[model samples]
Target: MAEALADIGMIGLAVMGSNLAQNIERNGFTVAVWNRDPGRVDEFMATVGAGKKFVGAHTPEAFVNAIARPRKIMLLVKAGDATDWTIDQIKPYLEPGDIIIDGGNALYHDTIRREKALRAEGFNFIGCGVSGGEEGALWGPSLMPGGAPDAYENLRPIWEAIAAKVDDGPCVTYIGPDGAGHFVKMVHNGIEYGDMQLIAEAYDLLKRVGHLTAPELAAVFAAWNEGVLQSFLIEITSQIFRAIDPETNQPLVELILDKAGQKGTGKWTSEAALDMGVPVPTIQAAIDARVLSSMKDERVAASQVIVGPPTSPEMPDKGDFIMLVHNALYASKICSYAQGMAMLSTASRAYNWNLNLGEISRIWKGGCIIRAQFLDKIKQAYHRRADLPNLLLDPDFNQWMADAQTSWRSVVSIGALAGVPLPAMSASLAYFDSYRTARLPQNLTQAQRDFFGSHTYERIDKPEAGFVHTEWKELIQ
Candidate 1:
């Protein structure tokens, strides 16, 4: 018997890994697979890999040996310790110039550390971000690969072949060195958090204030999906509202628990932004909303104890409210993207990643969780002005904001008066307003900081070079 060779080897025969392997095989490449558990390898070989051109290996060494020279092995294991352990297990079998691609939702710093350690040992480590869940793994997902140019060059053909296409171009690109790909993916998840929260807020307003039934809300979301709001999240949200519970014969959404869960990427984004001194209020607010939602018992108790205005605000005209909610959602979404992009810009500069924001937007236009018609406009914005400091400042987005401001404000105000929680929406509006303001109340904040902690404050009349401290209680001292 001859040793079977594979173009690429993938470890961790989980759903994502198996599907991605199948996708690679379907695209005219032979894939070798291995899993931590032998049963999984045998199961996959018996099932999804049964008819595919696959080489199933029971051990890491076998997986490495089955691949062709300068092996391409991708790890789709759990992030953190598992990723490190897998690398340790496979390192002995890998030779110089071989590539190891991590396709998990890892912290960016972890990717950076691993890349540096591997590259020093003559191996290429690529932290690749794969988006669009199981279906995407089997078909086409947006791929973001970050590593040395040589490694990317070697993997480019396979990546481009298996990636989603938009406007006849693959949704895969070299994001930059080290962890740039995973960093972008983390921000993508953060923005996804903001988007979902904003949509949920809109739904709450429509249901609580406008008194719409679940089916009616579904219709509204479905209609919005045809316009600028067209995106994966919105499309699924509409479907979610329309789903009926098999047991209760009521809308499944209503029957579900109110608690929301997270897997850390959103929290990582917020933490990274804070550490970098970048403001991502919309993302932060979305995370906060989830934290608040998780306190379902506390919220229920508080609702009974903490009373608001005796009556809820009267519902506005349905036609007008619908348009207002639409504008509000669109405007807030723009702000959320702006915040995320701003964070990316800051990160790029700080880390010397040289990330191409325009290319990032282009790749995000399809086969990602955040894919949308609006991303086309975003791509255009970045293309028109490669150095676009913020999406809110883009000419088209600026004009859209101007047109939407009145309705956007009305929706927020109405939600407030009706006691409907609109954390993400309100935070986005606040971020937009703060960005546009030439003079913020931050001066007072600075002064208070200086007064309490002797922190220095910069004067508006002086150049940015100097930081001065003021004395507030000389006599008391």
Candidate 2:
């Protein structure tokens, strides 16, 4: 009989799983590796796992048996049916206190249901959201683990050792219970969509209206990376603009197809927001932008038929126009984060998650895809007031928006005049405007609903009156 020497067992030897396994082993813990296919295990052991603290296991029984007591097994396998199947395979061999972690992009509701099912069997299941792509996994990714507090405590050392470090603190945190981790990750993706779309709009306006070339645009983005807009996305955008096609000797971005692909997280964020009655219009617009991008064929056909606007618009002052676009991008980015933060705050209350918004923002300051310098400001904002309704209300963000409003409106107007669609940017501007306004035309909408469906409306003038229905047609007559 062999002794249980491995600290952790990792199933699924795919890119993310393999990298994460190496990361765990690199932090001085012995890791046991397995795969759905035995060949992958052999291959990993022969290649990357070679000369490392890794135990390659061939059977599910061997994998579970090799791990120490109160066994910790992480599944980096596909979400949905695959995750459930993997759990079932090893469930019989696990002890009561054993922990199972699913580190994949899963729906939060599914995570909640899985936790309930596993709890019934005396096991702890964690839905952990890992972010930062392939490189981050190999190095240090931001980790979001949602489960029992004791389960998190069991995995704390390994997670803290492997997560990205910023200002001497790790980017991993206990993100409440049940599905909070995955829900927060979904919101992160939604904000990422908004970020990318805003950057794309800024690129378009600079190219079409300001007449900047690829290298010139790259220089501009590089400059932005040095200032308040410094972010992973902005830095990468600069790199993307500078990349050249080796085959054609042209700018790579120009040669690439316009269509954008999504993996459903952004849509999930929007759907969840709609269901919760939270206004995530900027996130919704980002998803809609992707949907519109997919209709490239229709767009090309429409380009042929549409004859109203000229492609060549009068160019604006280069320096001043660049600043305008910068301010517009910054202002819109604030609105998108405001909406995402609001969603998180609402979810925390609705689900009884007790999520620490400041801690969440702090964890996002490092390895996540949406990592930004502005996140520190958000962390500070929430730290000052945990129950703050929205990021837009923060004094710093409020003043920034106030100063940028004219520039933001001008950029949107320019996009409309130039026949360039600014879906995310314009939607963010609208979100900001609508949020700040005291009175809206929705009263008319309420009256129309009451007249048609007798849904009823509330009276503003009468203090005691509530939920009243009106005979609008008879009153008009």
Candidate 3:
């Protein structure tokens, strides 16, 4: 079986899958390719403009037979019930100990469940996250493979060379055992939501007050593409702004709805964090903003909707406001990813995943959607202290926080004044403050706790037996 079609091939021929197959082929793995529609493979061969680099299987059975021994099949298709249907289609062709990898953004819980079900038939299952979008797929993608160590070891070489490199390091690694890869990707999407929301809030500010048009805004984002603020989303956003309507010759975005669409990963990240008793305020706010944006008509009908960002708009000049928003955006994005990383850490401890955060950062460099330079810092930060609470806890990141705090407040205040929504942005700053603060005002809280449950309070200066006998004395009654 290993000799028939070579090893390390894939199924499905969507743009993402097609590009990824091409990348695998480029990286020197002989890939046996198949799509749901076998006819499309022929079309793809023509479109690829390279006959020698890629070879396609004419049918599912042919595809299954092409793979060599200790068979590994990578599934790249639409997730959920459709994925199940495809798995069923391929089942009859599989033998015991055959491997299957789901590289789509399926739910982590679903991955765990799928692995269990597949094991019943003596199959090995892996859930991996493929990132860096289409171009990355065509070249090398950040690959996060999580499941059995043997399955990961078997596929390592193909993933190793094709992933983005970080200081001579490969960007692909085993994220954890079982469902950890998908879980990390879930948190990645959540952070993406928050980062996007912050940028949008900045746009709203520049549009409403700074007097910038779409073209001008596009330029700002383009400039950001080269700076520290650069990212995949920022790059795409610049292109999106340049898109125009053929009929009206106007910016297409201007005519689109204010609402946004989401698949379920971001929502799940927030929900999972809540279930774990973790604070991910910015990510949750971003998710909420999307949900609320979708309820557009209902709010207009009510005429009772609240308006504006949470901060007041005062005590800052225009230049200060811009810098504040920018700094705040940067600081906030760090927090979002930190939360995701924290979840992975927690889940790792629980699952005995023994995931290496630095290795995870290395793997995230190129093959995935969230690939960026910041990941280098993430790798460095985690390498310095594997148990560092978050990126912000790192010395360099801490200094960044101290510098940005004043500006964040300024931007939030301005957004409130200008009637823009900075839900995610403002929330990120708040999360940072709450997370960093050693002491938060809790007298009212302590009184309530003691009143209801007799929960004792620790004195600010002391720890043992700090009673609340001065509950009224503290008020000087």
Candidate 4:
């Protein structure tokens, strides 16, 4: 009988899986890699896996056997049924207490269900959120693992070794038990959607209002990358603008279609927020923008039929408008992240996860797509007050928002006048305003509801009194 040689095993051989396997091996762990299709295993072994510390397994039984007991296996399979199918194939061979990790973008509820089922069957399951795209997977990625504490302790060495390091610390952490990791990842992606959309709006304003060419825009983004907006997405956006299209002999972004693609993670975030009664308007607007973008045919038809503003607004000083855009983007980003943080806080309490917001923000400062210079401020804010209800209430952020409010309002107004859809930015501003307002018009809505259905509402004047119904029409009569 062959001896168990591999320290850990990975079951998928797609770009993400292959890169992660190589990363593990690079960290000095002997890794066993398998693919559902044997040919892929062969191809990877010959190419990316060649001369690496990798053991190619032909079957699920062989894959399980190659790993040392109690084995640690990660699945980078498709999120839904595919993950389940892969697990079933390996379950028969897995011994008691072996850890199986779902490293894909899974729905948190599904992760919870799987973890519970696996635990009942005398196994440990971890729903780990792996972020940082193909390149990050190959080098280092931010890892969010949620499971039993013992299970995390077992995998800690490997996770910490392969995670991106920032400020002399790893970007991997043991999130709370069960689905917390995946839930955090979902919100991360949702926040990423908002970030991308906000940056896109800023780019549009730079081009249309500021009259900056692609190269100029690229330079602007590069400059922003050195400032408060320094982030992976912003840095990439600069590089993307600098790319030239060979076929069109023009800026690549200019030649490409405006439509965007999305997986269901953003929608999941919005749906979960709705279910929890948490308002994530910026993230919701980002999802809506993507959905609207998908209707390319309808949009094309509408573009021809619907008349927009008669004239485009020209910025008196392009430099000054550019600064306004920077302020607007920064302020809007604060609102977007605040909304996501609120959702996380709500989920933490509801699920009894006891999440560490500061740690989460700290780990997100590197390797993840949403990693930003701004995250350090968030970490500090949470460290100062762990139970902060909203980031807008934080002293630093409060002052920043107050200082930038005029610029943000001007940018949104200009977009409106120019007939450009700045959904995320506008929604973020509205969310901020709505949150700050002490007295809302919802009183009138409550009165209307009571008049129609006798649904009661609380009275401000009647202290200590519960909900009361008033015949509003009778008072008018």
Candidate 5:
């Protein structure tokens, strides 16, 4: 094994894997190669790694045997159950203290479970969330790693040497404890859902109300990048809008559908929040929006799909309505992040994971899909106080929301008047206002409790609880 890979490192190359391997090799790391398909490695070396020396392994055992001493193998595969099977396949041959990183979206619990199982086998496991698209992989990524702190230290050279730089530099850190890394990535994806929904809502308003072309919308997004909205999400939205439809010469966006896809992370985040009793309204609604979108044909068949209002059905108010939508989107986005991070904070406390919210936000600043200007605020929000309940309540963020509420309200009302569902977006702002209101609709709430949990209710202005003069509660009293 030493002779086979002593000089450098090894990579398992797929399209992304190949680019990433070349990235590692380009940085002067020796990269041994393997794949489910042996042919792909040869092709990758020929094209991406041109003239690079690479070792190929025929089997998982042989692959483990081929790495150099104090053995280390980084597993880059599809996330979840598949990741576990890959680790299990390689475990028998890995020696004590050998490091294996699961660089995919395995559940944090799974990471913790895997860490325990492998450590008991005298091997160390690191669950790493490697972000940045292929580009980030080749250049550098925002790496969130969790496991034994010593194991992270052992792998720091590789992570730091291959990560993006912040003012603080190098977007890599030990996210603490067994599952913190995956947990951060989970929140990362949850916020991502809200961010995408915000963008889509923006596009929907601009297109529907302003009658803006894709190119026009793209230009607007590009300008946003120069302002408070400046971030990766806006940058890409600008580019995506500019793409021309070759046949029609119109913006390519018109050719696209109003549907989006997810690979379970968003749903998982919402589900986890519900289980923990966290009020993650924005993130949960984001998931619901996608589920509703996916039921397109069935919805149409059932006459359940409806687009309520025209862009400006009332007195040429389209522009005002559009601005309001933007405000609503922004505020709701804050709610989503707050909810997701709150969940992380809760899990961290209950599970004893001293997760760093500041570090997590900083990584999302650059690489990976969900990168947005809002993340910078989030980083600042947490940096100022690690224990902040949520980003919206962060002092500066609250100021921003206070300034933006009128616009948000206008947008929600316009959407309502115009007859757009605006359910997720409007509901997001509703969650925000509700959180801050110190009061809510509990008129039916007490009835709901009495109906099921049999809890007593209170008078409208009284602190004292009184059971309703209903059959069950009155008899029990």
Candidate 6:
């Protein structure tokens, strides 16, 4: 007989949405859930929603009516057009000051546009990045919410209660205005791409060169997981190796297709880095590796005719080589993180987002795909220097890289000599070397550009002066 009131309302009753709603309810807040299809709402109410403090609504109007004033609604629908459609459907029911939170993998630029438009209509908008996928949603996920300060203040308690905790702090923070949350999330996904590819390269090297069995490789990864490489991905990778394919009676990973699939976050990050003139070669290389892997037919055909070098490099002692691969993976991971953070730094300045880099690293310690034991060091690095240009430049990371360089180089060299494509690892090493070099061969590149396109070059002799052009024909003649 009485209208049920909810602290928060969630649209899109998909796995992520439903799990997040349950998480909210578990945190002692009542949640009102609505889905595009009323059948889903009825089904959820009958199953997962039965015991939970959930208010199931069949329509947007009922969902809005069930929420308390200055309503907080989270949209976990598909990113692009579906997000826009959901907003349009609910806008008439929402009053001014009501907050709409988008928790999808949307492009940051799109988030910015939506925020601006929603604000113009007198509604508050938040582009919140929800990481760690379905499990994280059900338990606790890292939350990066960017929007109006007032809206964030209102949503803080709810988010803080539901987010994963590292030490004593929650893995949720107010990431600047407009699209900042999505931007950081995009960079996170990019770093994940590089991290995964680096791990894959290590596996390839150990299998091809060391000739280790799947179980042995799994042991190696399991060992790494106990050390600095400890993370969700590495833990899962070890488990993946140990799994047997029911159909093939082989390691699940071996039985699976060679082609890797992507959902575009990595590509979006690469494109954003290029547009911002930020160097993220490791991320780019990871994306390229996926694209190359997708051409399974071409690769198989090419393998027959292309004919790589005959002599495979001699493998080092198994024990020594394992350590080398470990060091290489760790060092390259540092470089990839460095590049991802540098891009974030650049985007912060370019977009005037005033992002807190230190806090970003802190929140990423849990409930994110890139969460690792080493992230603590990254947090400290930024805490030591808030204006840190790159993670590689930090004293701790710098010392680690200096110590790891020998083994890192060895791994890369072995891959090259053996014709094993270590694109991500190689690119990371190249990035490190290029970054440390005071002077590059760019002067020659500039000269060639000037010769062919009259692009004009800046002279080192006059560092503070304007660009200069030279007549190459007169000198050649």
- TM-score list, all predictions: 0.97, 0.98, 0.87, 0.98, 0.90, 0.98
State the RMSD for candidate 2: 1.2
User: How many clashes does each candidate structure show, in the order listed?
Assistant: 0, 0, 18, 0, 7, 0
- Lowest summed lDDT window (length 10), candidate 1: 307-316
After best superposition, candidate 2 residue 156: deviation in angstroms? Answer: 0.4
Instruction: Please provide, for model 6 over 1-477, each residue's C-alpha lDDT reduced to its tens digit, 9 standing for 90 to 100.
Output: 886699999999999999999999999999999999999999999999998899999988988999998999999999999999999988999999999999999999999999999999999999999998999999999999998989999999999999999994999999999999999999999999999999999999999988989999999999999999999899999999999988888998887788999998999999999999999999999999999999999999999999786898878899999999999999999999999999999999998999999899989999998889989888899999999999988988999999999999999999999999999999999999999999999999999999999999999889788898899888995
Window of ten residues with lowest summed lDDT in model 4: 311-320
Candidate 2 lDDT, 172-217, residue by residue in tens: 9999899998999889999999999999999999997788999999
RMSD of 3: 3.9
- Each prediction's whole-model lDDT (CA): 0.93, 0.93, 0.78, 0.95, 0.75, 0.94
> Could you tell which candidate, 1 or 5, scores higher by TM-score?
1
Q: Give per-residue CA lDDT, model 3, range 1-477, as digits (tens).
A: 434466765888888888888877777777788888877888877787255556578877877888876778889999898779878888889899888999999888889999889988888899988777788788777778888888889888777877766665777777777888888778777777777777787788777767678898788788777877777777888898899999999999889998888888888888888877778888888888888889989968755766545664454565555566678777777877777788777777876778788777767665566666777788889989998867778987788778877877777776767676788777887788788778787767986786667675667666665574444435654
On a 0 to 1 TM-score scale, where does candidate 4 land against the true structure? 0.98
lDDT score, candidate 3, position 155 = 82
lDDT of 6: 0.94
CA shift of 246, model 4, Å: 1.7
RMSD of each: 1.7, 1.2, 3.9, 1.2, 3.2, 1.0
Note the residue pairs that clash in candidate 6: none
Backbone clashes in model 2, listed as residue pairs? none
Per-residue CA lDDT of candidate 1, range 311-402, in tens?
A: 77666799789989999999999999999999989999999999899899989988899999999898889899988899998999999999
